[model samples]
Target: MNPVLHAAKLGVLRGWIEFKQMLKNPQEFGFNIIMTIVFLVVLYFQRNKTIEGNDMALAMFALPSLLGMLVVFGGFMGAATTLTFEREDGTLLRAKATPNGMVSYLISRIISVTTFSMVSVIMLLMPGLFLIKGLADTSWSGWLLLLLIFIIGILATLPWGAVVGSLVKSTASSFNLTMLPLGALTAISGIFYPITSLPDWLQVIGQIFPVYWLGLGMRAALLPETAVLAEIGESWRYFEMFGVLGIWTIAGFLIVPKILRRMARKESGSTMEKRKQEMMSRGY
Candidate 1:
């Protein structure tokens, strides 16, 4: 086999093993379970409540949207945080020392992160099917669309995580730059509420980010046709969702390799030691 192909295959195997390890790790499994429970609890409380101007259960409206939000969160923040910590721990430096290691390393990260994100989605979804109504009728096409949106969501957001991870000097800054801002934006992105209810400018602002488009895409996949009544323009807006996410996807692909290369070139034992000292000084 070609060296690159062999490396990629090994990377895939490594990622799967890491993913299994994550499942076995008490802390990791606990975190996922906690998040799943928190979301379910919130949705449970919303079960009887109806959205303004619509009788559909708010939980039903929010469940798939939350799944969508999870995609962007897991893809971007997960990647950024992972990269930042691993960089601090010299994982990237070690990868730089091996033949075709960078490629294998990146592939493993993409696989692990993507699969873990999907596992989270499933963790939420399995219980969600029992907790939320109106989802029971989702057809084969809906499932396909949901799968496609999940894939595109990863493609759209993960590379941006890599970019932010490369640019930020620390995980603290990574969270400040990526997760904090995203959490704020998600408030207006309509994961838990209707976008149409927001001010016109906020609606416009919300639409510009992947979080909103992702929620909209997931809702389109899981909700009934009548649910469109609550959306902007009263349609699925498939074209717009794909168009915006595609732009992000393309831009990230074009930008990340150059950034990663530059960041890799600057990696050295001294730099790694400096980061370790900084992290220790911060009591991390």
Candidate 2:
């Protein structure tokens, strides 16, 4: 097997272990499931009937965007939690002392979070599809497009999660900081409404990140072409979506590894010990 594959296999195993641990925590799992369902319900009901041609089935237009949002939330947040919590607990420090530890650890996290995000998509998504009405018209090609966008979207955002995981100093701080921007992004990214309905400035902001385009791409894949034009613009908007997301993915690849390296440099036994002591003193 290839070195990358071998390393990835180890990472997958590590991630699976962590994922199982997360599932065993009922409060967290319940919150995640409820959050996803609530959002799906809201988005589905709020869907524009005009876009679906007087049908509520038009909710398909929102699925891709919501999937993107949910995936990012789960994967990025899960990773952020893992890294910060591990750092606080000294696991990261211990791992760093092992040969190939850094590689194994990071890869494992990416795999694990990606898996969790994908599972969330299935659990939350399919029910919305069935409840929404006319979405049954989706061709195999449409499904293929959705799957492709999903995979690429996951890869594109995973790097940002790495950057976030590397940057946040602790679990509490990460939680407090993450919610606001992510929530704002959900609203502005056309996940619940048509991007064309947003202000020009907001549309510009949408273009600056992948979420908007990811939503647009999802709409393109699952909704009717005419419906998309009515909601966003022309069908050709997908090419633009492809272009914008592709650019960010490439840029993220360049920046994230450097950030990870710097973060790794800061991971020392003494620092971990000090953090643990601080947490212990604070009754954490």
The numbered model that scores best in TM-score is: 1
lDDT, candidate 1, 1-284, per-residue tens: 99999889988998898899888998977998999999999999999999999999999989989999999988998889888888888999998998898899899989999999999999998899889876878999999999999999999999999999999999889989986889888999999999998999999999988999999999999999999999998999999999999999999999999999999999999999998888789898
**Candidate 2: stretches off by over 4 Å:** 1-6, 47-58
Range of the 10 consecutive residues with the lowest summed lDDT in candidate 2 = 49-58
List residue ranges in candidate 1 displaced over 4 A. Answer: none
* 10 residues in a row with least lDDT, candidate 1: 128-137
What is the lDDT for 51 in model 2?
47
Question: What are the lDDT scores of the predictions, listed in order?
Answer: 0.92, 0.73
My TM-score estimates for the predictions, one after another, are 0.97, 0.89
